[model samples]
Target: MVLVAVLVVVVVVVLFAVVDLGPPHATTNKAAIPNRLR
Candidate 1:
């Protein structure tokens, strides 16, 4: 159970890192989403 908890934490950290360093396409889509909603 402890190992599973550690793994989940590590995965969350990696996901955060990837999102922080995300590619331009991902950022563009995020921006475009708001405009599309309007």
Candidate 2:
């Protein structure tokens, strides 16, 4: 059915979004924000 197809697509998109593409504890450089951004 059309409804079933749409549901499958939605579920696939949600699963893809939840997939992690990197290590959980990875760190990155932090940059200081300008005064205007605070």
Candidate 3:
């Protein structure tokens, strides 16, 4: 049971990270994201 819980948590975290790092092509301010991140 514990292992199953850990797997689910890891999967969710990975998905979140991927989505966060992906480019937001829908917006016109594509260059602004990296500047804000720095």
lDDT of each: 0.72, 0.50, 0.70
- lDDT (tens digit, per residue) of candidate 3 on 1-38: 99999999999987765576565454634565576578
Tens-digit lDDT string for candidate 2 (6-27):
9999999756534532223323
* Model 1: lDDT to the true structure: 0.72
- State the lDDT at 16 in candidate 1: 65
Indicate which candidate wins on lDDT: 1
Give me the candidate number with maximum TM-score: 3
lDDT of 1 by residue, 1-38 (tens): 99999999999987865665555476576676566568
Query: How good is model 3 by TM-score?
Result: 0.57
Q: Which portions of model 3 show Cα errors greater than 4 Å?
A: 23-38
Q: Give me the displacement of residue 38 in model 2, in angstroms.
A: 28
Give every collision pair in model 3. none
